[model samples]
Target: MTSPTPQAPVRRPTAADGFVVVDKPQGWTSHDVVGRLRRLAGTRKVGHAGTLDPMATGVLVLGIGKATRLLTYVVGADKDYDATVRLGVATTTDDAEGQVLSVAGPGAVEGVDRPALDAAVADLTGDIQQVPTSVSAIKVDGKRAYALARAGESVELRARPVTVSRFEVLAVRQVTATVADGGPDVPVVDIDVRVTVSSGTYVRALARDLGAALGTGGHLTALRRTRVGGYDLAGARTLDELEKQADADGTLATLPMAEAARATFPVRELDEDEVRALGYGQWVAPSGRPEVVAAISPSGELVALLEDTRRRGDDLARPVLVLAAH
Candidate 1:
């Protein structure tokens, strides 16, 4: 008689290197997503490119393993968001989460017509100086502005120049609603807008400024990020999906680091000897790409991220981050 023995299934490696586009759910802090991914990925090396407010949702870029070093570039990339700005009321934080600061008078929203809105949006377009809301993540005096604001301290953030690449108004609707602002109910105007701004720009502040320009108070009622640089919602996966993937297979899907680098920066291939030399922390010749470039080996592996720097009066390729030895 012949007997067969069952064998254990092979476990795939969990230590991965690449990016994960997350469709972050509302009410979850950016740090919450990072911590959850760390547990799911079975590594504490996970990091995010940018932070999203707890009320916002959509594309949140995460880096695992060696890709964590590339988050700087992603963090500075252009961003897109779909937001709703209520023009009849203002808030302490310039967002819905804060207490009502002031409310516009009756019939105040009627003056905010399409022409007026367009002109105000145009004023905000191009390069403009903007002061972030006091309840923001900006650091002041070695402490977070929000922390200070929450502790009953006045947080006065300085105005910084930021670019509003696009401020497209998708739709606008005026709604009359009741309010509990320690007074009788009043009419309100809510404007739906989509904005594309520079990395440091604040969409909530835009709503506040727009209301101020229109003689009505403003606050962001809703916000959802749709894109970050080249990454968008199309490539993003929700947290539930990630957990399901982990349950099905003891690993979460991640974009290959080499492929992610190729998609992000200019590629510069290295010969057999060059890849090996860089593996030993040696520098290569000028890549001619000027800024950072992905140094790929002949086998198509991302050896490192290289940048040209003036050393010894010569433009030489220096490793910005060494991802692999060979």
Candidate 2:
């Protein structure tokens, strides 16, 4: 019997197709934004660079069509957050979302002056191992840590190395509030902090660690991501604005793939031949830079991600991601 006719390979979208930076609203999960974008863009190929907690609001880099290749690079870049940490209480999730596990009495944490807070923040800066919150998205035994914790399982995550480039206390205030159990009143000290940390670093963990250092419980009250790599809230379009633009033009507001890559990383321009070779996933000569750089064509099109690989005495460079031909 004759075999069935060979089917043609599905054609993927081109690098010209990329993502839009969105200022996600509170209570909307990252997946929710992606779903909206998929409908807005009239395409199913939509993804985000990173995941943000539902309570967090800030810049979320999205990838459209073939630009999804850029997510890997974006995900590894440094991140910045402006957050509020509430002292005098600890929670199961390390944030305002979870149940209160413990409460320090009113004025339990006095004498936490600005100087002391500054010193605490200083100690958190630089390279350190951080234990992610039990309710984090990290997977344990192929299941999300948060899922396990929610199921009443005791989760103990190991500390992982992370870099906190900056941790500054912007403001601090002490306030009184009633507990959920209708118990006696309590005093809570709220600290506003701005942090810049490497990938995988948890802002909630930072708050928890800070409280641990101060001998008082703490948890994140609010968090707003300000920056992700080169994308910042300054350039993000809100969902309402995005919907307006989509309705007005019947086309989604998307950043060009080449532009996105260049904005996020250094660029190396390639000639027509090099571009062709890259599109075919072939190797090229080193550009003398050891870092991974986005390779673009003369016409402002992203061709591939190029990086140098050294083996013995030979230095070879190759494309990590080959974008579709322009």
Candidate 3:
């Protein structure tokens, strides 16, 4: 009699099981949430999608256990934010955290008209090159730019291409301010805007660039992320709620990988034979469909992420990330 197929040893849970969409609180770093989850989930494999600065608050995507594999796909997705940009004052870091670099007196921006603001915002729409804030996470000579800046070093970063598909000014408010230089006149306008942009686009940079365009200088006063891909703050729970839930039930709420994937990508089911072929990393004949990644399944269970590949003049589909065997 043939011996039964040996079973693969079950791997220990390493806190990398599934994903959790947390409504991150302001003043907490992404790493802080990871540390809290590490203790709560009882595993050390927690990871997050995009990093939200301590001053910003909103949906923060996190991965646990095998779900960590999903982060690679999540991080590149488009992001959305609602922000408040204050004019008349420019800061060193481009946000409220930095020291005031320059201040214009009252009436500096008094005559600025709505049409001018609209045109300036329009110029920022669509594809454009943006210079990131000096205090960003970008690396400079193997050191984080923020770290270098903290050490009193001069930081200069190059511009990168980013797309701002939507930049709509929702409201505007004017405020008079006293300049640190004791200037007689200082008039500022606070513009509230909602933006939808490609990944890596900096909203702080937008405020700075917009100020430069208006010739009055501007800095971001408040920033909040509303969405990343299909994940949104609407479906996210605050860390405090998560902690309370864990205390009450001994389990943390998590979005299953399949559900999260479906929210982010198109689904493509596979039959038993196809699942078997994918188990060994083999390619199946393509269905002539055009999707970068398809959620392949067998018997109603997620199996892998498949993409079309051309081999020997035959269109074949191969696995990019395999989740389970046949």
Residue-pair clashes per prediction, in order, are 0, 0, 12
* Model 3 agreement with the true structure over 1-326: per-residue lDDT tens digits: 99999998543334336789998888999999999887777788889999999999998999987888889788989999999999888998888888888876566687678999999999999999998999999999999999999899999999999999999999999976654557565678999999999989999999999998988889998999999999998889888888787777667767877787787777887788888888888888775667756555655666788878788888888788888865
- TM per prediction: 0.92, 0.92, 0.90
lDDT of 2: 0.86
Give per-residue CA lDDT, model 2, range 60-82, as digits (tens).
Answer: 99998888878988999999999
Q: Which window of 10 residues has the lowest lDDT sum in candidate 3?
A: 9-18
lDDT per residue as tens, model 1, 22-90: 999999999999998987777889999889999999999999988898899889889999999999899
lDDT at 42, model 1: 72
Between 1 and 3, whose TM-score is larger? 1
lDDT of each: 0.89, 0.86, 0.85
To one decimal, what is the Cα RMSD in angstroms of model 2 from the true structure? 6.6
Ranking by lDDT: 1, 2, 3
**C-alpha lDDT (0 to 100) for residue 180 of candidate 1:** 72
Error of 3 at 100 (Å): 0.5
Residues forming the 10-long window of minimal summed lDDT in candidate 1: 7-16
At residue 220, give the lDDT of candidate 1: 94
